[model samples]
Target: MGRHRVAIVVLSGTFVLDLAVAAQAFGRRPSVFAKIRHEPETPYDIVLCGPTAAPTSLGFTIGDLSPVEWIADADTVVVPGLEEPWAPQDPTLLSAVAKAAEAGARLVSLCAGVFVLGQAGVLDGRRVTTHWALADEFRAAFPRAHLMEDEMYVDDGQILSSGGMLAAADLCLYVLRQDHGQAYANDVSRVLISPPHRAGGQAQYAKATTRPLSGSLSPVMHWLIENIAEPLTLQQVAARANMSPRTLERRFRTETGDSVAGWIARRRVERARELLENSNLTVTQVAYAAGFGSTQSLRRHFVSRIGVSPRDYRDTFRSTPEQSRTVGRPQQGPAGTPACDAGPDARRPGPFSFMH
Candidate 1:
């Protein structure tokens, strides 16, 4: 297969990290896998599409960038988060983005970039996500788009959207996995020192709960997390919470947006990840410690919920002293700017924002 063309549509007021993260993920050659003969080389040809002069959020300018016309040949069209995502974008740029989508290019947005897609009418009736802080505004702005309030990312086949700035990396890794295989994606993830595959449904990395649980279910939720190691059934949970099994199931759905079993499984997987990152325990030991009955059970849940097996997760996240220092070094881009998926700044983005 030939290289797929990926055009990152960079408008004025683009978020610096959003543009750089996609560039780093899809633009770089898999140089680490050169020695492996069987690996696929269907690398992406990343084209930056923007105005003659692209203004960025970090007080820098991207000059001599390609025009919106370049999107005509793209297999995928990505819009990075804009500092002004809720404002109106240039009509010419919106037209180009819409045309590309209508021509069968896969559409992707990072953070508030979903606003651009919504403006272009590409996100209508599609499942999507944006920064958690902007969820209320996005829902009001594009009522046709089903915004997943807490998801890290949403993959609606051709149309993809991710939550917040850091979630851009998560979306990029997912696209890489879809184009290549899991092993290839994992290898590239190791090179970038990031998780290859975080589940799209995982909650956003936000501040502590300003919004409390809907009702008296807080005690049950806390107890579940505390006793995750025990093989507690729904009936058992209901008994402890002083409610019937049916009531417990309904309340769990209302308060947590998931089933009783699913919430427990996700929590256990999180516990396993914590142990893997912080302890020197064996995989079997970690499995038992996190509530899985056996190593096999741990592997199954870990792969399903966390996107990697126990050993591999530990290998990437729990590196030795020396390896840890070198693992997270940023890859160099065209100039001196470090190629990394950096997080957003502390300032809250404006509502109904759009790129210029």
Candidate 2:
């Protein structure tokens, strides 16, 4: 297959790191399996395109920029933040983005760049995320869009939206890992001086939980996070929240955009990730502790939900310094938590959570 042609569409006064992150991820060479990936000499063709005058930045002005045609012919298109998101964007720019989406290109937006995607109406009926500070604005601007303010990035199928600058880096690393493999992406992370792995639910800059003036679902959600080990049937949760099970489900979906079962699994995964990241839990222990019935069940859910194995998940998001540099790291969590899928299966994204 041909190399994935990546395009980064630049605009006036774009965030510096947003462009830099994509360039670094796509432009750099890989150490492992280089020969297999490239036939001696081939690299990703990263084109920075702009339709108007070179967007000015700190000390550097983008020039020789390609147009949206690059996006049309590309596999992935990244849209960086503009100088002012509150103002209207150029209609031409929005049109180009829409075309790329229709063409089935994986669309990505960094920081406030999600606004551009929203302005184009491409995020309609889609779940998206942006920086927490501007999340309220994003919600107000796009009522139809399911705006996720808590995540570092919302991987809503083909289109992705990141929470902040570092989250952009994390997202790029994630894409790299998905495209190549864990080993190759680890090398890139090493070069970037960042952790080789970051669990997706590690919360974007820890949520600031202020006192709720009223009884919002935030308290119930907070309680759920702390008590994952307790009996948590849907009706039990509804009773605790003082609402009907259906109302509870609706509120939970609105708050987190996931079904009750899905949210529970995600939280279990998040908790499992935390144990994997922070503890020395075996796969069996981790699985049981994360509320997964068995190791195989954990592996199945982990891979399907989080896209990595339990050991691999532990290695990526383990809270402590791992002694083993192997691709998959073994772990055991706090007592009573059985490790899930402790066998040869390496696709288990055990359990993990850091929403606190």
Candidate 3:
């Protein structure tokens, strides 16, 4: 079969890293894979599509790019983040993007580049994500779009978007996995030294909490974090905070935007993830370390919040002597299915969120 065609649309003041992420993923096969017998050439025919010359956000100029009109012929089109997303974009470029989407070409946006798709009117009712800091502005500018700001990346059928700059790599890898298969994407990830699949949303990296803590709840939150491994009840926590259970519950809801139980459960899941990735703890040990009552409790929360089992997550992320034995091997989950499906709804688990 012919190679898939990928067109990366470059705009004025484009963030160079965003452009590079897509290019690196689809542009060429890594030299490390060259000597492997029977290895196929890169499956994507990538072209930089834009005016003859454009200024990047880094104050450098890129010339000799394919014209914007070439976007119409691409099987997939990517828009990298722009330095000034709210500034006016080239009308001709937006028109071409719209045309490509209307023709059923897959559309991708990295970070603020989602603003370009919004301007092209293709984002209406589509689930998408961008840098979390830009969430309010993006919502205001494109209220018709369904914004999942908590996700690191979102795959809404033909339209895909990433939360921030590095997430561009995540979205690209996901698309590659969908087009090829898990083994192929894993090979590319090995070459890039990136995880074949990241298990959680961008919320893990966000510098700010989901909600700002009031003075009354600030100490309580810190205490919770410090004692995350303890199996303390709400009443115990309330006593520690010197408040009635009823008052503490109301305070938690008001300050954290989540019930006390819900907040603690999320934190426990996060703790479990940390132990799985960084420590050599077995699943049961990690479960107890993360404050889950039992292995069953840990598994239940992992499936609900992370979309994968603790064992699968560790196998994918942990650094171990066995890593070389399993790194590029295709993983199978329940009922002999691929550990992670790459279909339209594949990204539903843990979605993606962005920092900054």
Alpha-carbon local distance difference test for all models: 0.78, 0.72, 0.82
| Model 1, position 18: C-alpha lDDT score | 92
State which candidate has the highest TM-score.
3
Residue by residue across 24-122, what tens digits does model 3's lDDT show? Answer: 888977677765424757888999999889999999999989999999878999999999898877888889899999899999999999999999989
In model 1, the runs with Cα more than 4 Å from the true position are: 1-8, 15-52, 65-78, 83-87, 103-114, 125-214, 321-356
lDDT per residue for candidate 2 within 163-208, as digits (tens), equals 7767888778778787878876776776677775565542424433
Q: Which prediction has more favorable TM-score, 1 or 2? A: 1
Superposed on all Cα atoms, model 3 deviates from the true structure by an RMSD in Å of 9.9
Model 3 regions more than 4 Å off: 1-3, 37-40, 209-356
In the order shown, the candidates' Cα RMSDs to the true structure are 13.8, 8.7, 9.9
Expressed as tens digits, the lDDT of each residue in 79-181 for candidate 1 is: 9999878899888888888888889999999998999999998888899999888877899999999998678899998899988988898898888889887
List the candidate numbers ranked by TM-score, top first. Answer: 3, 1, 2
TM-score of every prediction relative to native: 0.60, 0.56, 0.65
State which candidate, 1 or 2, has the greater lDDT: 1
